[model samples]
Target: MNLWTVQTLVPLPVLVPLFAAGLALALHRHERAQRFISVAALSVAVAAAAGLVVAAHDGPVVNDLGGWAAPVGVNLVADPLAALMLLISSIMLLCVLLYSMAQGIADGDGRTVPAARGAEELRRTLQAQDADADESGRRDVLPVAIFHPTFLILAAGVADAFLAGDLFNLYVGFEILLAASYVLLTLGGTSERIRAGSVYVVVALLSSIVFLLAVGLVYAATGTVNMAQLAERLPDIDPGVRLGIQTMLLLAFGIKAAIFPLSAWLPDSYPTAPAPVTAVFAGLLTKVGVYAILRTQTMLFPHDEKLEAVLLVLALATMLVGILGAVAQDDVKRLLSFTLVSHIGYMIFGVALATEASTAAAIFYVVHHITVQTALFLVVGLIERRAGTTSLERLGGLATMAPGLAVLFFVPAMNLAGIPPLSGFLGKVGLLEAGVVDGSVLAWILVVGSVVTSLLTLYAVIRAWNKAFWQPCPDERSLPARAPIPLGMIGPTAALVAVGVSLTVLAGPLWKYAERAAVMVMDGSTYVEAVFPDGAPRGTGESNEVQDETEGSTP
Candidate 1:
């Protein structure tokens, strides 16, 4: 694609939602209009992202925003990796939007679906007893008006981060999402949400402050904030200064990615949000942080052994500590939350390896985890909506009472636990294989940690399932008669589950794409070339990036 075309398509994913968010805010009184607007905007974004993905297979396509070229103006790049992320993100957004719209319709009025007349009374009684809980998710619920607009903005921010080629714009992307997330995280104004939102906001602000400082430092050091220029200049700077820059930048990104020691905020904050809110946040937000880490690690400091070693240790700790927390949790949402932290370790493992194959494995796992995690959370939301609690002690007989919900939950739950013949299993296997290829002691330790983590994940998930689904309910009130999850909700949730399966079915070709993306990411020159076509900086001599590409050719 030509630069003009690329410019139009590359920005559309971020721009379309931004414009639609305005419209959504304007049309706040008209629920149908806002819903239709959201669906249409995201549909257009998905098409744009899909096109970009197809185009990027040839090489990256770059756009100079505002018609100004590098170091002076913003740049948007649709490299293979960015394009792939954007495509999956768009798809996930649409599905979740569908699910949210369905949920709003159902819970907007507090009437029970065709149940025994007494069941309605019981619901009302339960509503009276748990007034705060009802208010938290059902009464005074987050309006579609605000939810749609903020969600659109959040989606745009994610897209921008993936496409951004400048640090300032990247910072802007993070802020855009962070602002929206603050609102989304505290949607119901419940005490738990307020508490969690406060923690989230505080953590987010610190990260942003550090991020801003890092950007200023980079500009001060290199005379530019453009990533390509930084790539060029960083090599010429003193090793100490470069390392300092890398340290600040990674520390900032690490908190955002929720890497261990920096991850204390995630499990506490995420579980309190409403289901759709939590699902999207879980699926996309930290991954954005991981994406930043992946970009800066490979692009700015290519292969710093010390940093890699540090990340390896962090990865191991994250895996063990996160899953152990999951095992200790009684709440499914919180269990999943800790698992979210744990799984990030897998991606970091790929990153620490700093090889094309390992990077490819990480990328593939990222996609798989995004789908499976979101789907599982959506299922969790369904459980809450149907059974009225996510506490395993309160939830049971779901297998017999809500068989469809059981199936929906089972598929993704197993996928997430890395059960055989599922995408999650395949993704983990790829990561493990890459670790084996590395054959270093640290790599072997991580591989072992990963396996143990997966087995524990399965055990935790199964334990929850057996308690929530297979076992008989402790009381009749735990489940109402014939409570059906609406088709609107089921369809969207099922769509994501289908996507999880697709990863397994298309694992071969997608793995190749990830390998190609890994090659591009490792070879910083490809990125620099795309951003600055006139002339781009090459790493001093032939680096591992070049060697990896050379070896990538051998196979």
Candidate 2:
């Protein structure tokens, strides 16, 4: 019952950001205050999530909202998995915020204009966009005030999704994040961004509709939407009905996760956003979808061989197709977007295997990919600032001009390619080892596809590096005049790159923690008991530690 226990930390990740968003919005005229609030809020979230990661090692830490019990009241549950995700996501959010603030400073107050455009040109562009909007009956261009608040909302939504104790709450979290994302995706209100955001909004709406319909069907069929309750109830439902619900959930999450065939929207959508927005979206948004699938598959419907087989095949296709697309890309942002899609297949491969080792590998891969991919995107932003374009054909001699940028780009690039001893290599090795342990025909095929995908990913990034950094600039006059790179932007990006490498140095403990988290996920009883101990709803405002005390007192 102590106020300072880990349970107290559970909601801060969600609540702090939501509250900060309000403050940031209120103080939008004070850019300094807004930046401080955003950074401080996310910093607190990161610290709280770190605390949960340590405390949750013993078991789950639950906080029933308003003293209400599970299956009735909204609650937050921070097991090792959710805690780890929260920590990583908070870190990414914080780093990207710094990068964006720096970018805003360079672009005149909080505006996010292209570096190539002069002040007069940017003013004209905004005026033109506004004029076009008025004629078309569209919303006018948003001012700089909207960015921080919306970003905080995004952070809150991600936290809520990770800690959600029930399916409906998870759906709410998804909607919250998606709504913020649509705003962020269309930040500049440019015609290109509008086109990309339009496609993104349509696709996201479709996914939400399907997810909501599935939730309704699930409630109708099972009488409860709490994930712990569903875990117990799903096995008893008609197998056909269970499968139908399962397929629906997968379809919705698959589109969000950008699994092959469902992934066409990503490359086009992500590349059009501003760099910081793209970095966060690339790193965290799709991973949230992956987390949803992992949670439902392991807890609600474990060991369905048929479903696992299908996932494995899809994993293979996602890998091969994504990499092939990456190989064909000429733009740096689009290339990274494709590789992002391809690497997701590796995570899916691990999830399909569904063993402790495989699941653990999937968790590790998610963490590795989040840091490395985000760092890579941030570096690309730097490249664009330096060269005025992301076109591979036009970029060259960056290595000679900005050696620091070259290093920043190279470390993550090689890691993404799965070079030896890096976190990427370690994650891929873990997944491959799990596949070998599986030893089925489809598993072996996935193993081969993964290897080929890794190789192709290496080829794609290397080609990008050679062209962007090493090759000659075809038209030197087309390049922007070199301004000193802002330390604010470079600092956060370098910090992310270092964190990516740290994943390698700290692999031993991180991997073990992942294994423990995987065990908790695979064992539904652990989660169910944490939520409803002794087969009864918990008392109002009760924490998991209190439940343990009550259990001990029962004689």
Candidate 3:
């Protein structure tokens, strides 16, 4: 219970953001104050997560809430997997916040406008003003104030989900982020955004209900929602019921992760949001679902060949279907969104293989994808800003006109396509190698599917690059050169692009850490022992027995 211990750091990622969100909301009228609050909070979170990553190298760091122990009171656990995710996500969140702030998003009410119209004009107008409208649009400024607080809340929600020790807490975490996403997605009240937000809301709500039902079933069956306890109790439940619960959970998370067949909503939903919002969503949200699947599959139900086989099939379909969607897209944002869906399959593939090596590869891939995907979306945002449109046909000669932007787009694009020595390639290589080790007929099939997906992904992104930067503008009059791209905006995008590269530079250590984390994940005892060093109480509801420690209070 020391103030500076790793246990104490477990909840900071969640608490700091929630506390800052309240402060940010209070100071919303002062955009500078809001920005400072958000930046400082996320910075602190990033630092805390880094500490946890090192501390958790020893084992999972558990913080029991109100000094209550596990199987009763809720706790936050930062194991290697959770800490790794927290660190990467916090970094991404901080970078995107800086990018949005630089883009002058805080000064403007969210609204769509033609690129030829200066950003200054769009920033000052929320809706069409009446003839008697005053020169200073005070109403417009108030709407822009919502961004900081909501974004912080979203950050906290993601952290909470990552560190959540119990199924109910995980569900709560998903709802927190999803609710904030609803607002962010529909910020401008544009018809398209509103329509897309509606669909998103419905789908998210449906998934939440399914997840809740799964949690309820879990509690009923095992009499405990804490994951550490569930890991011990789940195998003891009826196989049929366990299978049903597992399927329901997968179905819920699959929808969120945008695994194909359940992914139709994503391309439609994400492209409608503002660039920063879309970038963050593309980077973090779906991976959260994938993280959940990884956690539950490895921890709660290890060595389930049936589920693994089904997952492999879904993984192949997701990769092929998603890339095909991307190949057909004309708009840069939509194409990136589809690629986002497609790359998720790689992570799923790593998970379904369910070996220590494959799990490690999945972890590495998630880190790589989160950084690379967010960078790509942010680049697309820049493309939209410069050209006034993201339509591939309308964009051209950007390699000459904005050589910096072209380089910015190309690095992450190739990295995403799994080019050599890049983090993306390293991550993919890890996965493909793991699949080969497995040597099953299905694994071999997925190996082939994965390579095909990578090639097609490269083609999809290169096609986008060729059309947007290489080809001549379809109509010369459509694009008017704009003012110099802001340094603030370029700084964060470049920083993220740099992080993606750094992942490659750091891949040796990263891969080793992922391998260690995977060993911890594949061996559930590492997590269960960390949460409850002594054997945990095994029981159903009030019928269960409890043991007391000298300082412990029973639930």
Candidate 4:
């Protein structure tokens, strides 16, 4: 219960990986040393995030840095939503690490010889060096060295974003993650990856700049950048000033979230990264933007009708347009990337509704989507590895050769399509039910859009399944003998699929926690109170009314 104890515990999730990142970088020359440091750091972070979730199950836990009170010094706040996000992000980091290990092994085995002849000599030279390094007892370490430190740093940044209590600190955390992502996205420096990474970096930097401008405006207007303080003072601000700040912040976050029109960069950039990196990015980055939206809507401008409507329209457009893009894609990664964009609509719909049930549904969907989407992407990666390419034209008959991979892809694909008895279906049901209870035309539109999008997603998944798994392998006579899949690669993919299945099995408890998280987020007063024990109070206003209606209608 000591306040100082909280600070020590609070920063561990962020610090562990950061420390590991430094160690990994220093030991970059020794691959084994770097991998050990990276994995150890992530293991500790996962444990810490789990502990934080347990501690915050009942309420928020606030830690003031350097023993200074809020408004004067930084604070780290852990609410249920933040804890849940941290836990999911940590799980994703673990998967990415495993996948990286697997890919490294494959690449090291001379399996990754570039399709072009020009690179074949480079590959042979590298393989020769690898053999020499192995003779020197350093062979295993060379394949996946950069992955450890880069991924550890990425995890640290995500944890920082989840724990951040101030607007400026959140911005800083985002930049940290963004910088790490730039490296990961362009890691091999392939032409496709470099082009994609360039777009991603430029778009992300622009969004950060806009976010900084908004932060500056908020500070200038309110005299403080602490989220708790901003929440308290937001209601008292001039309507015009509040609107301007809200618009600027939303635009920045919207781009990051890939909401509707601002989403063009995502599909183009995400598909070019390595599979594990793509999976982690699919799971974590956009959610950070959604998290920002959730924070802004509930805490900063709770009762803005115009803003809510705009969000509603954007959600609809995003759902429709993204799925259409998914359906049109021929490559597995590109298809999944568009699907990722489409699902952002579901989260936006929940936020636009701004009711407890809808918010709870949003939280549930976020968790479920992260697991399901990451699993599917990894499965696609596995498919690419087994079949020699991710394009539908090159990938076929996987179901016969790799039944395990097929099952892994199918479960999440079904769940993502919102099929019955899955977490995705349950989440969509919750959103639709919330829409009905709200009794608004916008809510009804969202409900309809949800159903349509679900069906379209099913079509996209079925298309991929038919072309990649069910159909006969094209040029079967010319196909090379299938290479052995590394146990390390399969392990992480299996773990992610297991997590998705577990989500379906434990939907009840998970949904309950999600509801609690939604309530906590909607009622920002508790968060503010946790952060600033002596700060001026903030009103819950319409949020309380929405919560009451939701509770009254709950079965």
Best by lDDT: 2
- Candidate 4 on 108-127: residue-level lDDT in tens? 64222212111233355466
Ranking of candidates on lDDT, top first? 2, 3, 1, 4
lDDT of 1: 0.86
TM-score for each predicted model, relative to the true structure:
0.90, 0.92, 0.94, 0.91
Task: Report the Cα lDDT for residue 442, model 1.
Answer: 96
Q: Which stretches in model 3 have alpha-carbon errors above 4 Å? A: 1-4, 105-141, 480-483, 542-555
| lDDT (tens digit, per residue) of candidate 3 on 251-343 | 999999999789999999999888889999999999999999999999998989999999999999999999999999998888999999999
> What is the lDDT for 431 in model 1?
89
Better of 2 and 3 by lDDT: 2
Which 10 successive residues of model 4 have the least lDDT summed? 110-119
Q: Comparing candidate 1 with candidate 3, which one achieves the higher TM-score?
A: 3
Q: CA lDDT of each candidate?
A: 0.86, 0.90, 0.88, 0.83
Clashes of each: 0, 2, 0, 0
Query: Measured by TM-score, how close is model 2 to the native structure?
Result: 0.92
Q: Candidate 1 on 76-96: residue-level lDDT in tens?
A: 999999999999999999999
Please give the lDDT score at residue 379 for candidate 1. 89
